[model samples]
Target: MGYDLERFVGYVNEGLLCCVCRDVLEDPLQAPCEHAFCSSCIHGWLVHHNTCPEDRLPLDITHLRPLFRYMRNDLARLQVRCVFRPQGCEVICALESVHRHEQQCDYALLNCSNAGCPVQVSRRSLEAHLCVCEYSSRVCSSGCGYTVLNTEEAQHNCVSELRAELDMLRAELDCKVEEVRHEMESRLDSQRRHMVQKESLLRSEVDELKGQLSRVMSDVRILLGAERARRQELERAELEKAELLELLKKEGLRPATPSEAAPPPAEVQRKLSPRSLALDCIKRKNREVTVI
Candidate 1:
């Protein structure tokens, strides 16, 4: 609601009065119809009826605007008494300054600072009342780390309070420890799973390597067998060569005994020369060796 009309030092223009409350407009707003009302009054009225309170004309919150500059200046210049005048404050000020004055007014009533204190005291006496309020609180002199109310001072037990605080701390510590333990367990389980995967991967790699090794060993064994067969064949060829030499000796075809050998008849010599016969035998042996 707007300020009480009686609080003004002189007559207030009717135009400055709220259409809803009929009081001097406080934080006034004007409708498109040129009628003004206290902002709160207009908003509250609009909640029930969407029409200008003065003309009953169609209106809405969207149609409201700030009061005209001249009207606002006139409203601000009006002399008003302190809101706490009934409480012994005798200050008077412009309408615009009334709120500031009342805020600092020594006679303004305030709720007690203490919790659960129902008493309201004037600003001038608030400090004095707070000093004696039974609900007022202060830290325990016994260093129990707790605020004790004046009313409960006689029953306050410092030892019990401290014990309860210790118990609370212990419970919090236990909770933190349990949390850390669970986190560690979770980490360990994750590591174990990772290790298991790594081990499986490693085993798979090892098996792969073993299979490759087996293949290599099989190839090596085959090569070794082939080499052995080649060596034995070479040995057999050498033995056959020695036997051929012995047979040539037995047939009296040795060139070293040419002086002791008998000469063939001219007819036999013409049919098969000795040099030609030797060359034929060599050619036959070369063919057999090439086949082997």
Candidate 2:
């Protein structure tokens, strides 16, 4: 196959391709003089005379080359076998396409699900592999360890904002609860004071009513006593008056009073006696009453 100049220059700059027999030269070797060549080319040149191609220095198998060799494949893998046989990539592609298959293969992986994640994925199927991958999600900026889903990037940002708002609400609620508690305590204290004042007023009113009731009872007792004494005096006076009228009726044949003494008719004057005249004199002076 013809060599591509651009690819050849790139391989050279990378120090991965051999200078001679340059078709991705395999089995690189080094001379004791610190010069390098392909293993086959080195062996052929050494058969003629044991000397380095770049420097005419005597060579031996024991020395490592001073120039750094671009490592192509491991020593144990030199035997002919499919590159991806162990990884379930059964396609037997050459070494060039090995790196390509490893990139585009379904089992091949480049990195974690998080695009900027720095971890390397050693396994396959990124979806199934990263499902349980701890490094697959972006960290929460809210200082929480909670991981955000890949499909919910926008939603997670929204939730982060809502978490800030929730903190504010909690603070406000605490303030309101304290305010309400203080208001209730104030109301309870006012009610207690009012109750004490009202109790004092009621007790005073009860005392005044008791005093009024005692005065009214005392006045009634005094009036009853006075009424009883007045009734007795009036009864005595009535009896005395009745007795005076009876005396007057018995002495009807004589003059009832001195004021009644007058010149009588000649016949009536002749019938009057001296004893009757003395009794009339006592009755006329209004001194004849005897209560005994």
Candidate 3:
């Protein structure tokens, strides 16, 4: 169905030819009366009439039968040239395989898929044409909105690649600077918090030391007051002792009896031994003044 029937013009067997198309039969179908016609031709005829084209016999699509095995084997051997022969294809193929060969032929003409392209290329050249087609669009690598065909891409100079790169680097530098600034600020805040804590600790220690010093000073004052009272008591005792000794020396002495000359009682001896003896010597030295 894909090959041109004219390409098989003189090489077809008359027995295998379709009555309607006058060419080699392809997918031949036999009517109820055994008349053979190409399936496509008979199908098109049955669209208007329910009768076979050869015998005018009553027929429906359901009554149509496939051609015998001999007809198919004969059709398979029929030689046909590629439909793209005018397009530079020189290969000859069997009628049965002509469709397959034409489908893959390099000389096959293909219309460009691009809607704005009007070029017809060979099947092999189609791929290369699509690559450089003017109607095709592509994005600019610089992020500039200059999408156009490769043929006209050089007309618009929306942005320079070097300038775009410089802008990108500048933006990155600004971002890095901002990041560094934020990091520095964060470190400063952390250091300030640490300093505040250290100051608070130092103040607490200072208050503790002050409290300790105040307690020590109070203790020292109490000790000094006790020491002063003790010193005053000792001075008063010395003064009273001196006055008692003076009185003793001033009293008139009794004549020494035998018993008085004897040792005094133990209790009196203990009180008057060393200090009283010294006082007696002082009194004797003064007796002369009083006796005179």
**RMSD vs true structure, all candidates:** 8.6, 29.9, 19.1
lDDT string, candidate 1, 1-292, tens digits: 8889999998899999999999999899999999999999999999999999889999999999999999999999999999898899989899898888888899999999788899999999999999889889999988877899988988999998888889999999999999999999999999999999999999999999999999999999999999999999787666655755554554444333333243444553454435356644664554444334
Quantify how close model 1 is to the true structure by its C-alpha RMSD in Å: 8.6
Model 1 — which ten-residue stretch has the worst lDDT?
254-263
Per residue, candidate 2 scores C-alpha lDDT tens digits across 87-159 of: 5655544445555655666545457757656765545666676776644566676766566665555567656
Candidate 3 RMSD to the real structure? 19.1
Query: After best superposition, candidate 3 residue 104: deviation in angstroms?
Result: 1.3
Q: Which digits, one per residue and each the tens of the lDDT, describe model 3 over residues 106-183?
A: 999999998778999999889999998888877765567667567767775665655777799999999999999999
**Total clashes in model 1, counting residue pairs 3 or more apart in sequence or in different chains:** 0
List runs of model 3 lying over 4 Å from the truth: 1-5, 127-132, 157-292
The runs of at least 3 residues in candidate 2 whose Cα sits more than 4 Å from the true structure, single-residue gaps closed, are 1-156, 253-292
Candidate 2, residue 27: the lDDT equals: 55
List the candidate numbers ranked by TM-score, top first: 1, 3, 2
**Candidate 3 global lDDT:** 0.76
Alpha-carbon lDDT, every model: 0.85, 0.57, 0.76
